[model samples]
Target: MKFNEWTIKDHYPEMALQDIQPISLRAYSLLNRNISALGPNEGAINLLGALEMLEALDYHFINFTQIEKGESPINQKHEAVAYLNRLGQLYFFTKSRFTKKYIPDSESHMPKVIEFISIRHKNTAHRSLDSPQKEPDEYRDRQAFTFLGATTRKFLGNEQYVFPNYNKDTNETEWFYFTPAIDHPIIMEQSYNLIEKIIKELLNNL
Candidate 1:
């Protein structure tokens, strides 16, 4: 789907109008629209940097995953998984924009593309290679490797996992990453504004 038509609600059903007060929901929707409009080409805001910058903007941005969803599997584990999966998908989509805009002639740049893909695969493999330990915690860490995005990792108390995509060729996992629900309206607004600013700044440099 195009960025302009995407909504937080599609991914985060927990935050329905009935779930959150109307005013908050409105604010959230507005914010989501704003962020959705920031295509990578328009401002060149790459996914990894954008996500990290958003997290640093404020405490709310960092803790967005922890917000109460009033649903099953609502613990930190679920929240972490949900946020990570959604964020990864977000990165993937944003990366596509970047690729289309910057690497328009992929056929001409096949070698370069292959090199890039190799680097990306290496990075991801480095992060998720088979573990040496068989303990439950190690297993949880591995699951985190598979499920969480770089932005969501810090929130889940794992700060060492870096954004490893160098070639953007890996597609071993798929998860729907998005906002938790309609209750956290502030996030929608914050994300939208932040995305706009980031895109604008990135475009200026490009």
Candidate 2:
């Protein structure tokens, strides 16, 4: 989220293909490749900033087939899911590079990944943190968190959750915190690997 990223015209990867999604393109543009600027990363936002930053990217699931400018919630989600499912199937679920084929897995959880992108975009990227009624899709988010963490090198396992104690009271969640995994450095490193692959693959074939 730096000005220089946008200021440098050369920083953008040209989209020669019409099939390339705009949200995905902009997500990469927002990437901060250099960590030196971070100084001493002590806080959660700074510590897991790379991961969270990527996670927070606006992944609008656009369905040209079912276009809705201003419509009902049900139609919105349905069309979005349908479109994103198609996108996932093409880009992520099937790991084919020109010739070589690497089928993802028997139990590829791409649907959940799409759902997370939807929920996360709405609850996080689209709104302020001060908004009290955050969407409750923590379970849906687990697959995304797991996949992102596992794809990276050297990471231990853990489950995440949310809860509360109450006399109907615990002030506003003015602040929040979560412990990042010990192998976060590895996660950040692998993200670079993923980014490079994505940029090269999505560019003009000519």
Best by lDDT: 1
lDDT of 2 at 144: 36
Estimate the TM-score of every prediction: 0.27, 0.24
Instruction: Tell me the RMSD of model 1 versus the true structure.
Output: 13.3
Q: Mind giving the per-residue lDDT tens digits that candidate 2 earns over 72-141? A: 4445333333433333333332233421222224123223343233333333232322343433344324
Give the per-residue lDDT digits (tens) of candidate 1, residues 1-206: 23343334423345653343333333344345445444333432353344443343232333544455663322444443334444343334334556445334422322322323322333332343443222244333544454344334332433222333322245332232223343123443444444444445444544
| 10 residues in a row with least lDDT, candidate 2 | 159-168
User: Worst ten-residue run, lDDT, model 1?
Assistant: 159-168
Q: Show where candidate 2 strays beyond 4 Å.
A: 1-23, 27-59, 62-71, 91-94, 99-195, 198-206
Note the Cα lDDT for every prediction shown.
Answer: 0.38, 0.31
